[model samples]
Target: SLFRGQDWLQLNLEELQQSTTISGLLLELVATRDIREGEEILLDYGSAWETAWDRHLKAWTKSPGMYTPAHVMDQVASKLRTDEEQKEYPYADNLQTSCFYEYEQDTATADGAASSSKKKKREVTTIPWEMSRTIFDWKNLRPCSILQRSDSHHHQGGHLYTVRIRNRPGLAPNSRIPRGEMHLVSKVPRQAIRFTDKIYTTDQHLPQAFRYPIGIPDDIFPEAW
Candidate 1:
């Protein structure tokens, strides 16, 4: 919004209002980055339009937080490069490296399979009690992820909350992560956010990165995943 060199509107917009830190906003913007499928990631630029130049070399030029966007671009570019320079790679094989949740539904389902028309367009009413034990257990709760918003307005008609399932490195190569990609949990809990609260009753692999403040109970989490 640089019109008269001063008067302007910042393009900075977000789905959340609680983010207050520069790094937090920066990271959110980075998370919106579109990295094309099937790409080997790179993180640097040598000259103005250079390939992934070593950061040690371009440390003097590029801004601090900008590296993420550039790296994502380079990764997409490399992904599209000719096969001569590329090797066989999996198509979104390791999501932990990307943690692209809420981008789409689970791919485990058979492609092109038909679902109920009402179920297709309508919002999923339940979280399959066995699936979301904690969220179901709550006396009153709100969905935390953006997918629900896509189907219906929030209970409060305000913005919705999000939970990012960050990368977990220790799972074996073929480990079967028996959990849905993401789920919604009430942002502000009526009671304190602990194991007794609700979320802890479900799988504990979830990250603590909730838009609303919440804590993990030590009993449920013998060790942080």
Candidate 2:
């Protein structure tokens, strides 16, 4: 099932402190609504990591090395695994400690080999790339398009990240994802005409489709960008 903006079932992470009876990294699968048999469960991973790529892209345009894919993976790795590379990436561990989980190297599978067999130490930073390639299998995932339309007037809303696509049940047959604000400039020539068979409507369908830019607060994490 696809991740919906508001899912009936949610995956929540909670702290497993000594005062609590929960052990290990607390992972709870909660249902906000009653579920019938054979129904699918869905969860939203939140907007923080969802927009991390866009943040990294903008940051990379300014400071190439610091926001490089490798560096960003290092940042995610620092939280996911160990921050042993703290000497090299002092600011990489931006994720809060409440979300941290130790890397269990022994849990990794070995191809038809004995469990006692020796294996080389795995690099924590590469896990992000591996996850992007393997478990997530992003290439086979749903296809998402980035769309933008020029406004006749100089609207600041066109430059802000206010618009977002909603993936929910019971939408119109011809429904389309909202056009994102022009956060990044198109490399294509301005005179170029790009035609598509798809049709998208703005500020007409869902009330949540077009929100005022000022309604959303600025992202608090400046370092993320």
Please report, in order, the local distance difference test score of every candidate based on alpha carbons: 0.28, 0.27
Model 1: how far is 10 from its true place, Å? 62
Per-residue CA lDDT of model 1 for 116-196, tens digit only, reads: 336333332222111233443433222222222212333244332222222233443333223433332223211211111
Q: How close is candidate 1 to the true structure, as a TM-score?
A: 0.17
Q: Per-residue CA lDDT of candidate 2, range 118-204, in tens? A: 443522111110122242322222211123333342333222111112222333333322233111112112111111111232122
Model 2 scores a C-alpha lDDT of 0.27
User: Residue 48 of candidate 2: its Cα lDDT?
Assistant: 59
Q: Give Cα distance to truth, residue 189, candidate 1, Å.
A: 11
Write down the RMSD of all candidates, one decimal each.
23.5, 24.2
- The number of the candidate with the highest TM-score is 1
lDDT of 1: 0.28
